[model samples]
Target: MNVLKPLSGSTLALLACMAAGALCGLVAEPAGALAYLFGQLYLAVVNMAAMPLLVVATFFGLRQVCELPRPAWRVGTIGALALGLMVLCGVAGTLAGALAMPGAHLPEHAYATFGERLLQSAGDAQEVGVTLFDGADAAVSQTSAYGWREAVPDNFYRVLAQGHPLGILAGTLLFGLAFAALSREQTSMLGNVFEGVYRTLEIIIERANLLIPVLAFGTAAWVSAHTPPAMLAAMGSFLVCFLACAAVLGGAATALTARRAGLPLVQIVASLKAPLLVGLTSGSATASIPHTIEAMSARLGFSRGIVELIVPFGAVFVRAGSALYFSLATVFVANLYDRPLGAGDFAVIAFASVGAAFLSSGKSGVATVGYMGVVLSLLQLPAEAASVLFVTIDLICEGPRNVVSLLAVCAVIALVSAGLPSERVMPEPLRAQPQVRAPLRFALSRGQLALVAGCAMTVASLIVLMGIGVGAK
Candidate 1:
């Protein structure tokens, strides 16, 4: 049985639910509305979990990286490259979308119709403006927004409008420091309690993860119900473009990396395709680890020892996709707020994206710790904006991210294992070797969950409040 079978099952169910919601809308109206609300709420919860998870995971993951030798350069180089690519993609993609926009006069209509929705989805508003269009068929009047927010929800608006989750995220940082401070060698009980808190958070995140699919289904169904055929059609093109961009970036990186490693890029990509697909569709790299490992070793000829060490290690530090997304997202959010980032801000963003990627892990739970904290503290960004901007589109980003990660890890494994005795080393004896498992695993597993959960919960709560609205109606 596939270790990620559970993840696959959930994803399938989500697809089914979306299909059902779409068709049900054609069959009737009211049922579609109900489906829409429930589906949306399901997504809401998932989104709820994402930010805090990112925050906590980031903190612990970074701390873990800090404990390693010579990781700064390895993690930093890949991260910087990933960040640069993402920023380029974001700017280029937005410009391309604007230049090639189908309807010249459609901007106002889009904004009037999708402004609230886009805000909810992307956490900011589009700078819609009038433009003249001279097409082959006819001259047309048009309005256009620069990015993907035109299709999302209202929660995004709330996030931008109010600086949220930042407060809660701030609180979590204080708590983490406090926990460490209170847990000096003398305070055994405090230390034990902190340890238990971390463990419990991991357990809860792991178990609660099972609910993601059910929620995903409901959300898809809801999206199908409310969105018109035309909107869905437009979204289809966007998804295609997004996937294409992700593939090109991933493919290029794999080829270049493989060339450097003297491995077959095709073999490496083919080995990772299913896992990459699963990861993209599910938007969870953590869930894709088992399959990634299997593909690396069984199909790609990596030793078990190498696969285990590099894959997991890569998951925490080499979040190529997340790094890309964060870079794009930071800029996109800034644009929405009408606070275009300057060189200094961009520099800070570059560093933060690298840090966030280092802090990110392949585990699904509580991985956002350092990430959430860093963004909120370093940037003048609204925390609620972060919560809304990427939640629904995570899978859209994860696909390429995982592929990049797969390639990066493959390179590392190839380099490391080429020097070793076995190209197919057993896991047991490999773990016994100091060169393979212990230090790596120890780095990944240390206090990762507690930080992830605490930060994620805090972010989620803020997002929920933004969507549901706080105080009065």
Candidate 2:
């Protein structure tokens, strides 16, 4: 029982998926393709929930930030620091990619195959071209003409239904602020309702995450089976560069966290093992929040005031890992196409990567790809092929990406807690919750079963239609 207790469901799932994916990659061609399809289908389903999850989560998170103790500057300071770290990581990754030159000198046949797959997956080259460049002038002109007209939504429902995530985020923030302005009784009532919704969404998101291992397996098998051996070597170089950058940043974050928390680096790392393992296996810092808060408040003895405020805010806003990947990926794709990146191009990558990190964090299934597309377009590089290829190996990078983000959160918590007055710290009795051991069950609820069925049917229909479309072609 003790041995079994140590292995979490996500850890077991990760190992199982790795083994299955490697076996399929080596000996199962048709199965690999099918697995890839399932992976995409799973991503699509998960993505359907990402916007709502982020919207409600951010809404409540902002409330916490707004209600922070009198020195509002503390929250702002932590936020600024987190943002700086994110951008710094991005710059580092870009520099590393520039030096490493991953994916450079790819074999012609491998490049051609990737290009063909990209074109097929993306479809409508004309549309891609227009979206890539044509909107820039209009966007710039609109920005120049900014007024109430630009800020006000003509149709709020349309903005949400059409999946304008930034618009939704803006709306949620505005609503959160308005709620904060309400009378105490009214605010509490509404806040409770919103919190309930947020908790429910969190549960759904957690359940959806159980599919991650299957998604990882399918993606790994497909990439291994389809990609050329030389291309794989190039990808290996990119992975090394990315991992190296993340490790350096992560190590620095650990040192800072330990220093700020007044604990040894080893102690801090040891204390974070549960959250770190969960973050790595789940590939989500957001999903690891409960454990992170528990670790910080209970094990590490941080005050609730600091723990409750910074951790959630950091989870949604601080995205060092995503920023790093975006910068590294942009450089890698540029190299694959033999596109030369000057200083100006690197600057654009850095800025765009940071901007995209904020815009796409808390979303699902390689949100970085969309942001990378924007970066590619800005650099006048062909984006679709690169975007597709990036998605292929996104799962492989997710674990490290999440770990970096978690470490950033911990670092911010430590920094914020250290700066607060000693009196602001919670008393020991309030700081620790009694440990409760309960039987662990691994069964799905009825609602989860229904959701699975619905997703399966939707995915099947989409796959069938896709097959028919291919046959027609």
Candidate 3:
């Protein structure tokens, strides 16, 4: 009877799917798997739509800001430091968690019935030094659970969920940038077409998001219904590691931003209160943009121009929170499945986290899975399983991720401010003018396309090499 049928139908279907999965949990282990698979498909559909939406919004925003003259050396230096901080925090936290592996074990079975499932899962063998699971203290030896492979359909779902197809996110980003370029300068006919595409994407993204409550409720209900407390306990150490890494990343960015801003750390923390509140409430950075920029400009004395330009850009590139989340999430999944992380895997994770951050537009919801999907695909992880955790646990840690991202933006603005001599600081009003121009002609020229194509091909070759390595395992 609901008048809005598509919306109502999608919601009902998602809920029913989740309910069925949860009910299955009571039946048997296969039920749990079935429930998990259902959750995975729901997540996959949500995530597949996410990458293009986020990539387009982000690249378009970046292209719009790309023309602003900056002391690139200064901004780059700070940006690099911020990036390094994320990578370092990730590595260090992972190392600490790894070292702690010897003592980790699942909570007692009484806590949740899933402990048996968790333990059965832990039977798979891993390398000598690697700690296979976060909670388990026992080192996995070469045992019966060898040469394990995921169920096929689920495996494919994960591949796409991991989103690492060579140019998938990148291509979308390029298209977004191209779309934005053409949008501003083109005549009505071509412009109208591009606008239509953008509008269509916008509508689709909006509709997809309407399913969040359904997804969230179903995911939560299903988790509560199906997964025993022990499964939750089994996941404790992994969650702890992730939160710890996110904290380090967020904490470090906050400290750095406060220090670099030439203000008290408390003031820096206070400065973020507005944006943090917005980010937490809305769960989207793009939505929080006006508040974040307003707060920065009014309270923090950041010029509106810099705040607007830098914050938006920071949402994409300076995502310390999301970067750390993405990296740690991958590690957690690998750990969950008893997959070993090699040096090459580590490098891929680090670079990919940065790239994913760059590609993500600050729409605060679960679109992160899209980028995560891309990474999982590239790294060849079981992304479907990863998406299961993200949907269920988004509220658990998104706060820290958003805070870290905000701090990173503040830091960039601060760093930019520091490098500008007083004279070069444009008046606040002038800063908002059309300071950057889109070189549409040049951007669409044959040369740029060829260059991008070449880079794409090179990256593809490297990915193939990486795939071969993954295959060997």
Candidate 4:
């Protein structure tokens, strides 16, 4: 009965739908289109609840943070670590892209065709120009200087309506602070109300999450039926490199966190399976919040207060996966155009990519594409074609990206828990009966499992590259 949980059902459904969608896409275009529409509808349903959930959860989370001992230092330490990890992701992605050289062998005609299509789509008459080793002069001149004005919303309602998450986050934090400053009686009443709201939204999101398999089916069908083989082939190098990086980084992060927490790697992985699978298949880390909180507190024995405080905040702000993809995609586009990059250009890319990653939305690929434009524009690069190209394969890449993001959050949870006193951490509940550990012929722990999986993926990627010949047209 325990094995028959919602997460297991969802995972099985997702895998089945993906396979069915792929088959339908290959065999019948109309059927695939229908499935794709269903997926879009599911995405819309879940997205409807996403922002509200974030608002309520974050409000309560920040309120709790304010109650922590030395709250300022705790917040600062977590923020710094999150930001540092994002920067590392960006740097790693850039290095991988450079080594893979995704578009180095792109056919001239194909490049011209893509560029022409992009220009046509944008209705732009400007001649496409190419230059080598251009410094940050163009980027500096073209980029909008960041200021407090951009961070602060002009109208709270407009920001919320427009789904500007960062603005909402800012507004919520301020509101939480004000609530905290109230008299104890007033604060208690408001806290109860906020908790009620958070729980209600959490319930709504959980129900909405049951629709993920339908979403996966449609996305897989649409992507398979509509994306041309040539475009997919063109994206092969980038995809391989991106997935490889994700696997390695995610695995390493998970292992380190597990070891630091003094938990059996297998137990941690087992507990996290549901949220991880949901995140990967749904391509939305926010959708997995309920499961993440459960895994952290109920399963891994983290303090509920800390888990609640960190996960919501991390879901919105700590997007290591998005940062990685942005850096990699920028490099891919540069390679496609034979653009020579310098140390300064990479620095700008790192800065822009990390900045944009913080602003990534958890709903769908559309917001991601829009954000990529800002990053490209900051580098004074033409974004029209690159945006279209990336969006074409965004569905395929999104799952792994979400997985990486979730893993980062888990790592943060472990680190934060480690710093807390033992009394702050919760003890595991007593089971109805003593659970037996089954001995295996080859006993590989969860951390070792992660390492093995990562190494396997790396080897597979290399073999595929060699077999296909990276220069293949």
Error of 2 at 107 (Å): 5.5
Query: lDDT of each structure?
Result: 0.48, 0.70, 0.53, 0.74
For lDDT, the strongest prediction is: 4
lDDT of 3 by residue, 128-236 (tens): 2222233221111111011112111224445345554323434444554455455455635654564466456555544544443344334444455554565455566
Better of 2 and 3 by TM-score: 2
lDDT of 4 by residue, 40-75 (tens): 675666666767777776666666667767768877
Compared with the true structure, model 1 gives a TM-score of 0.46
True-structure Cα RMSD, model 4:
20.9
Question: Could you list the CA RMSD of all candidates, in the order they appear?
Answer: 24.5, 23.5, 24.6, 20.9
Weakest lDDT window of 10 consecutive positions for candidate 1:
139-148
Candidate maximizing TM-score: 4
RMSD of 1: 24.5
Question: Between 2 and 3, whose lDDT is larger?
Answer: 2
Worst 10 residues of 3 by lDDT: 138-147
Candidate 3, residue 372: CA error in Å?
A: 2.8
TM-score of each: 0.46, 0.69, 0.50, 0.80
Residue 366, model 3: lDDT of: 67
Clashes of each: 43, 0, 17, 0
Per residue, candidate 2 scores C-alpha lDDT tens digits across 1-473 of 33323334456656777678867987996887786787666556545655566666556655555666654686578778898888898888888888888778767776766766566555845434324445544443343343223234566677678765545555766776676566668677777887787667666655655555666577667667856565455467688888898899999999998887767888888778767765775555566666677678777777664665566666666888889988998898888777898999999899788876776655545665665665666777656557777776777788888889889888877777665565145434444667679988889999999999999999999999999999999
Rank all candidate structures by their TM-score, best first, as comma-separated numbers.
Answer: 4, 2, 3, 1
